[model samples]
Target: MLKLEDVVEMCRVPHDKKFRLKDHDPGWAGDEDVPKAKRKKFAETLLAESSAELAEAQDRLYAADTWSVLVILQAMDAAGKDGTIKHVMSGVNPQGCQVFSFKQPSTEELDHNFLWRYTKALPERGRIGIFNRSYYEEVLVVRVHPELAQAERIPDAKIEPSFWTDRFEDLNNLERHLSRNGTKVIKFFLNVSKKEQRKRFLKRLNDPTRHWKFSPSDISERGYWDDYMAAYEEAIAATSTKWAPWHVVPADHKWVARAIVAHTIAEAVEGLHSTYPEIGPEKLAAIEAARKQLEAEDSDPD
Candidate 1:
């Protein structure tokens, strides 16, 4: 079976200046041993297996109740964020997993610090929280549109040249704090090709079932594709830390991407060293008493 570690070396973005999206092949599927015709099927099978592993690991995490995990997914439009979340995380117990999709800010959200909205959504210990588009947008989208940054007006504020750099520092500090407090952060950037995005967008327009997903704004956003790419590159480079590193998952093929994502999550949770809580003497005595009562009731046979 192809393990998550098998692909991590290829997918994880190195924390260095040489990290570039153009160097990554969005269509690269794992396991060169598998033939091209059988790769998709094989990857799907791996995804199912990985999901089971993730579910078991998540159960341990929940039972231990000593640690938490946060999975952040970021990508261009039509990059399979929804699909990846659905298929890759399907086997996880819903009680232990929560998913949040960040859209435009509300009036109330605008009133606070940029990170305030997300801070409220952080997962509790012993659970997994997935963010579809997370606080990274403060640097990505806000950087692309400086007008959005103007809304975050500080009292008597002066715009500084290091604004974006400062925001990255804040995010790094936040992740460091979470890590110190037992929340492991895992971030994924679905590396979808521009050509593939166009095809997916067309499919959405041509298919009635997906028509609702198509919007004029989506088309407008395409105009800023290069800008968005640059923003993502810089933001990722600035923030990808050992405590909360970014994985650039090739998303041109949904199956392959899901397999990588599922395995990565399973591996991360498994590495947390969480285990089912050990029963104490008091709990064992209680169990013994319950067992005796049950045996007595059976003997009475009313």
Candidate 2:
């Protein structure tokens, strides 16, 4: 089995200014020694173990109530982001985990700064918050289709050459602020191959149950694949920092993506070294007194 630590290291994108999406293989599953037939099974086992570890860590996190976690997932269409999230977080306590999927912004959302809506959905201390797609959309989607920015109604100053650079800086600063405030941020860019995406789209088109997921817009968007790729590369290079680095998880194989995501999350929580709160003497005494009363009542005959 591939070590979870090794898997995390393999997937983590370094803070390199010259980072290129082509350098990372979308179909690169670690441990090529494993038979192809068994690769999926191996990933499943790893995911299960990591999920259990994450669950235990979450328990301590909730009891400690000192830190929160924010998981940000960004990916191209048909990258299996939803499936990866469902499988990796299946074991977590729903009460302690919240997921927000950012789609087309509401008029009210567009009126505020790009980060406002996201800030409102941030996890409270001791919980895990997941952003299905996040503020990076401003850079990725809006950058790809500049017309979208017109909706935000920013002044003509937005057309300046430094506009994108400014957005990236804003994102990095927001994450830094979150980190300093006890929110651990984990970002994943599910790197799916264009070829695999096409295959998945075809599958969705053919399957009645999945037809709803297929849209005419999906086909239209594919025409801008290269533009989106360039946007992703630049945004990631600019925003991936020490406080919240992006994990470029190879997502052509759903199993591999799920395993890496589960492991990364578990390792992050475990690294916090958080523990359950200690009881004070007064609280211990109260607990003992309550225990005695309950025991006495149980022994009494009505």
Candidate 3:
């Protein structure tokens, strides 16, 4: 997978000051009509190689106890995030792997600071953790519905502009602290086009296996179109940094998006320099003695 930095670098247009998700005409990804057979072949190759390498790298990560990896994925509805997680992470060892899918806050979750639930889900050292959607929702969703922000118990004076800015600072600081200690953070924004999302939504309603995934409310959210786009653009611009940046992935093609994700994970995992711990001299001698004793016992079994 391309580094989030690389993808953003390639896909964005620098405006007067900040960047946008690129304002291309028909589609953001371009040429979604590429022959399925060709795409399938390319995707198959990437997935196979990446899966093998990911297994090796994660084995080292599990053995070393050196650091943790945090991957946060966010996108609009029908952005293929669930499918992405399911496919991209197929090779990681379950023992060392964890995936968290965040949703609407429960009563208990609603009672605390927005960061409260997120902090508790961070990965332990020597593990890989994934968040399907994370703390950004506090800024994005709440910004759209000002009422929720008020319910957050933040002081009116302390709220307004400080809301998103404060969260960005908190996130940046938290990431820096984690990086200083050992963790690596990677964030992905599955950048599906509005038209493509509509197609996906229609498919969900039309296809049997996917029918359960759709809701009338999903279409309703589309009504807040430009508001969500502004929120996303601001969130991406504010939160992206050297420590932990959000990668805006081209998601019109599921294969391309999945390829990038798998490749990126393999690349990050490979950087850990993890290896199997060496056996001690005492343990080696014990193993030799045990082997000899077992052989002698077998020899006398007649």
Candidate 4:
């Protein structure tokens, strides 16, 4: 039985090479030798335990008020981005967590640099910020359709052979800056198989409650699957750094993916060793005096 910690290492993108999306297995959940039923049971149990730890770690992080965490999630359509966020983050204190889901940019957003909107949503110290789809879209989606890159209004000459490379450099610099400023970043590329995505799309079409999620454009985009995969591979490879490593999560099984994400977040925060701020002698004396005064008055009043 492989431990959850061991599983996490398998999902992390190595910082050395050009990341190839084809190298990762989308269906990877747990120990392959274990029976599927047992793996499922283990995942459920582990997730519940991890959730408790996450809540505790988050409280400590909030009290410490010295470090912030940012989680970036990117994936193909129906790859369970929303579900992963919903379940893995369920235990966090809402006051200490913020979620931003980015879609097509507004005209105002388009006027500024690609990272402008995302920087605006960066979490304050002692909070967790989640970006559902982030600035990476400028590379991934735009690379898949270079025509779209024109929206950024770069001079034609500058949008030469090095355009994508320059964008990647910008992303890397931004993440490095965040790290130096005490904001740690974790990026997840939820690797979902085409087959699974098709199944999910069909499921959404069949269920009335999920009808709103289905779109003709989503199907249209499916035709560019290969291009998107290539874009993701290049984007992840170029931008992944030690301070902001990417985790290529196998998102075929919702429960398994949720467990991985929850465990990753909890472990990252706990690793920071954040704690409630220590009280000074004067503060401690004040607390003692307050306690004694309350003790003296409370019983009689009651």
Candidate 5:
């Protein structure tokens, strides 16, 4: 099967502002035309293979004993962030990977600096760290609701005029710092259409098992979809630097979305300097002897 990355590169994009993965939502759910059955199987199969590839890549990093990855995902509600993490990362070695989901800030979290929680979660050497929704939220959500923007500690004089500009600058600086420190960061925007979001929202509302997933407040955000898209466009344009280019994954077809994200991650991981620990000769000999003894014991029992 063609990986999601390849398909995304080839997907016939709709007429929604030349909606590239990096700029706009692919609007899959409401897109009755996305060929759901075809996409579902393709997405799952690629996810399975990519999972193995991720493990192998991590093993190489373990041996190499250098470099880690930071994969940041940003999207609106019901944009398949959880599903992507669930299916795409199903095969990676757990010890070598971690996924952090950022939600509404608590009282304690609000008291600290914006990047406090994220700094603690940076991946150790040879591991992969995924942020389900991350530091970017400080800009996105806070921008959407000015009241929430209090978290940004900008100067009172410059706050109103340069709020978003400062955010993009901060984000750009942060990613650059990570790159210099040997952590390769990749940002993904799962672009889904407004129409598709409505379908997903409805599905969550109507289905009993999915009932717990629905939130009435989610609809309130839908009104600002256009505003959010514009925000994303500016964010990507302003911050997608050469060292950390953002890939806009088309989420209308979850398979294509999965494939693209996984492939990109696999490629980045494969490019890293990871390798297994080199066991000494004495340890190798001891293990060989132990294996022979165990084999002999099992044979006698049989």
Candidate 6:
């Protein structure tokens, strides 16, 4: 079994202002002790163990009803965010988890503050909320294309030097607020290499079934790769806090990314130290009475 500490240490971004996107290797698989040929199986084993732990922790979280978890995933196209989420969270009860994919904003959504739509979708206590792409988009995609911000039509919405900085502060404050209110926020950036992304994009174009996943816009965005990288570096550095931190998971190997994500989530939920709610004396007595009545009914000839 992979130690949670090891997995976290491999993926968690430090809470420092000098975080650099280039420092992390998108193709990292884990310790060099594991031979390349065996890494896939090792990742599967780690994922299975972590999935079991996450399921148990989720049960405790639901019973305690004291805290909620918010998982945020950000990645370039074809980085396997959907697959990671699918595999890592496969064991969780659907009723206790909600997954929201934020796409193009509606007219109604654009009218509200950038954070308003996301705030409304936060998970209530006892549930886990997953944001496939979230408010971080305001800093990322908007930074790459300044035209989108202007489209919001905010009064005096100037693309000044401090614009990105102000948005980062807003994100930090919002996460701190959520933390204070018993919501644990965890973010992940699935770091994929440009070469790997190109390979995947080509595979999609060649495969008939995956053709649906291809979009002209996806290729268009590739032109802004450097811009997106700078934006991600700045956003992650400014927002990774004690209350919430970003995990830069290498995405070249799908199994490795899934395993790390599963382990990290299980660790966070376990850290909550949640337990089943204690039954009061009156409730216990009522339960005993109902149990006796049920036994009597079962024993009766009628």
Top lDDT: which candidate number? 6
Q: Counting only residues 3 or more apart in sequence or on different chains, how many pairs clash (N, Cα, C under 3 Å) in candidate 2?
A: 0
Summed backbone clashes in each candidate are 0, 0, 3, 0, 18, 0
**Candidate with more favorable, higher TM-score: 1 or 5:** 1
Relative to the true structure, candidate 4 has a C-alpha RMSD (angstroms) of 1.6
Q: Scored by CA lDDT, what does every candidate get?
A: 0.90, 0.90, 0.78, 0.89, 0.76, 0.92
Give a tens-digit lDDT track for model 2, residues 1-302.
57767778777878865688898899988778888778888789989999999999998998899999999999988999889889988889998899999989999998998788989999999999999999999999899888887888887656554988998999999999999999999999999999999999999999999999988989999999999999999998888899999989999999889988998999899999989999999999999999999987857577
If scored against the real structure, what TM-score would every candidate get? 0.94, 0.95, 0.87, 0.95, 0.83, 0.95
lDDT of 6 by residue, 39-101 (tens): 788789889998989989999999999999999999999999999989999999988999999
**What does candidate 5's lDDT look like per residue over 1-302, in tens digits?**
44444454543233233343443447443234556676566666667787779878977875565798899998888989999888778777788888998878877777777788888899998788999989888777777787776654434624464877877888888999999998999888888877778888988988999988888779998988877877777666677776877777778667667777887788778877466778999999999999999887856555
Superposition error at 62 for model 5 (Å) = 3.9
Q: State which candidate, 3 or 6, has the greater TM-score.
A: 6
Pick by lDDT: 4 or 6, better one: 6
Q: Which stretches of candidate 2 lie over 4 Å from their true place?
A: 1-3, 299-302
TM-score of model number 2: 0.95
List per-candidate RMSD values in Å: 2.1, 1.7, 3.6, 1.6, 4.5, 1.8
So what's the TM-score on candidate 5? 0.83
Ranking by lDDT: 6, 2, 1, 4, 3, 5
**1-302 in candidate 4: lDDT tens per residue?**
88776888878887887678888899887777989999999888888888889889999999999999999999999999988888888898999999999878889988987889999999999999999999899888888888777877865535554988999999999999999999989999999999999999999999999999988989999999999998898888888788898999899998888888888988998988998999999999999999999888858655
TM-score of 1: 0.94
